[model samples]
Target: PLAEKHGVTIETSGDVAVSVGSHALLLQMTMNLVHNAIVHNLPERGAVWVTTGVRSRVVVLAVENTGQKLPPQMAATLVEPFQRGTGRTHTDQAGVGLGLAIVKSIAEAHDGTLTLTPRDGGGLRVAVQLPAAPPDTGR
Candidate 1:
């Protein structure tokens, strides 16, 4: 809904189905990032891009969006519980800021890592990297 409303273009690639600790947790993480990409984007001309790939023994899931730049200090604390970006705390789009926090928690629980990088142009890029599981063998 947000994507359609903002006309955000979503481009995806790579093998989406990969062995992970928990599918449900991953779904939640990806959904939150994607939602944030749309909600926190520019009012117009917003864009989102999602991709997945395997790097070494890790599975990478990344979401990138176009929006206003976030300060380094704010971005650093974004994964903290209840920490939200400026001007986003009192608007209709206001969030409790638990989204990224929860994402980070879940990643850590699975022995993975989550990173948020400010984009070169504007907006942010979030990536969650988890250890890839060995292929299932016939039991």
Candidate 2:
């Protein structure tokens, strides 16, 4: 829905291995990041890229979009609950800023870590890293 709203096409690649917990949480996290990218980006056609891969012992997932640059302070506080950026002018988007916070919590609960980096082309890339599932040993 958000991708269509901003005329932003989404491209996804790679795979993930989950040992436990509902896949819904991961889907929600991806949805939140994509929605934020669509809502915060400059109102021009853009693209959102979602990629997943295995990095050493961790599974890495990244969502990146094109948009206006974010202030360092605002970017730092993006994962905080109810935190909003100073440049935010959109009022129609219903968000209390708790989406990232929820994502963070869910990641932590799964023994994973979340990171956000400002992309070079005036956008943001959010990543979630989770430990790979342990090898099964027949008991």
Candidate 3:
């Protein structure tokens, strides 16, 4: 949906089990991240990928996208309130620049952590790590 509108491709994979405090909040977090990714992309032919998994009793979700190279300094402040990244100009009602900030708050509320890393080449990688829920075991 958004991928097509943004002229980008979206790829998702991995585990579907998430044990957040509220599913609705989780959905909001996902929406914000995906929206931010699509709206802030390279404007054409960009790619966004999301992955979910469990590691060391922690559930991990990562959203990465190709975009303008972000400076390390700028990236560190991306989670601050109203702090927009460079080249964030987009006509699609980009947002009030609170996506990462909201994501950080959501992760913290779940006793989790959010990390923003500038990708090696260009783009950014955002990771959310929270406590994992044990296997269902068909109970």
Candidate 4:
């Protein structure tokens, strides 16, 4: 597993029972989260926690990692197309900053929502929530 190769532990919990969108989009969104977790972490070695479950009428998928805390202003801009934060001093992890924006776009296309929160202690947490699939009528 790439997580193991990178020394990033994964903690997954709960069942994600909804199938509300294209599999491609789901994979893309998840990969984006994983990539961001690995790339943007503090590089001091940390774990990535992925949790999925139904909360109320929404299906929630969360990705969390330990890393340098992002500035509140920059966190607000994270979903803007091609907008890289001026606070990032790491040149090696360079990115156009479109990843989260793309994720947001895909989520919106699926009638879902994306959010980012500052993790307590340290790091960042990214969450995506989608409407639950309609009940199967077996028609």
Candidate 5:
């Protein structure tokens, strides 16, 4: 998998029940996060962790990776279109830098939120929280 190519370990845990959202948009959001986690990671000791679960009334999905420390301010701007982070500007793997931007946009359309935070030691963690769907009451 992509994790192997980057010498990163993939850890996944937890389970999230189905929620309401556009399948295509959710898949796109997930792909972007996973791709970024692999493409932008520490040359050594790279690791990616994926998790999903229900918290309170929300469905949560998180993608985290071992990477170089990202400037907090720059991390905030990463969700904006065409904005690239440090060292990303010169990479052939770099796209137009709209990955996170699109993820954030799609998240909002589904009544969800996207957050980016720098992890202790090193690396970044992104969490997407979406409102859980109401239980169906068959008539």
Candidate 6:
């Protein structure tokens, strides 16, 4: 919804089947990630790409978006508190800047890891990797 309003499109793909200690917390973390993508995207022709997969026994949820180029140093700070990038300032929605920080905390609490990287062309890629749930033995 917000993507459409911002003239940005969203594309989702891949296997998202994964387990987490808390579904509610995972949802919250996902929301923040998605929100950051949309709110920081270009004015138009912008896109948010979300993909999930299992790699090396870890479940990966990655969210990427089209935006400005961020320096490696600046990009590293995005997960810190109150570290909002030079995101789309003209947009109607602005955040209090705790988005990525909260995400980092949630990922760590689940024994997972969060990674933020600057895309080669432009934009940012955010990934959360969590341990896959153990197979249910019905014990």
On TM-score, the candidate that comes out on top is 6
**Which lDDT tens digits does candidate 4 get at residues 1-139?**
6666667777888785594888998899889888877666765567888888887778988899987777676677878876654444345555767788989998899899999887776778889999989778999
lDDT (0 to 1) per candidate = 0.83, 0.77, 0.85, 0.79, 0.85, 0.88
C-alpha root-mean-square deviation, candidate 1: 1.7
Highest lDDT scorer: 6
Question: lDDT tens digits, residues 11-56, model 1?
Answer: 7777754746778987888888998888888888788889888877
Please identify which of the two predictions, 4 or 6, would achieve the higher lDDT against the true structure.
6
Q: How many times do residue backbones clash in model 5?
A: 0
TM-score of each: 0.90, 0.84, 0.90, 0.86, 0.90, 0.92
Give me the runs in candidate 5 sitting further than 4 Å from their true place: 136-139
lDDT of 5 by residue, 1-139 (tens): 7778778887889895567989998999999999888877888768899999987789999999888788788789888887776644565665778899999998899999999998876788999999988877885
Error of 5 at 104 (Å): 0.2
Minimal lDDT window, size 10, model 2 = 84-93
Cα deviation in Å at residue 35, candidate 5?
Answer: 0.8
* Reference-based TM-score, model 5: 0.90
Candidate 4: clashing pairs of residues: none
Flag the better candidate by lDDT, 1 or 5. 5
lDDT of 2 by residue, 1-139 (tens): 8678778888888876544556898788767877776776667788788888887778887888887787666778888887755334346656777777888888898889999888877888888888877767775
Point out the higher-scoring one by lDDT: 2 or 3: 3
lDDT of 6: 0.88
Q: Kindly give the stretch of ten consecutive residues in candidate 4 with the minimal lDDT sum.
A: 84-93
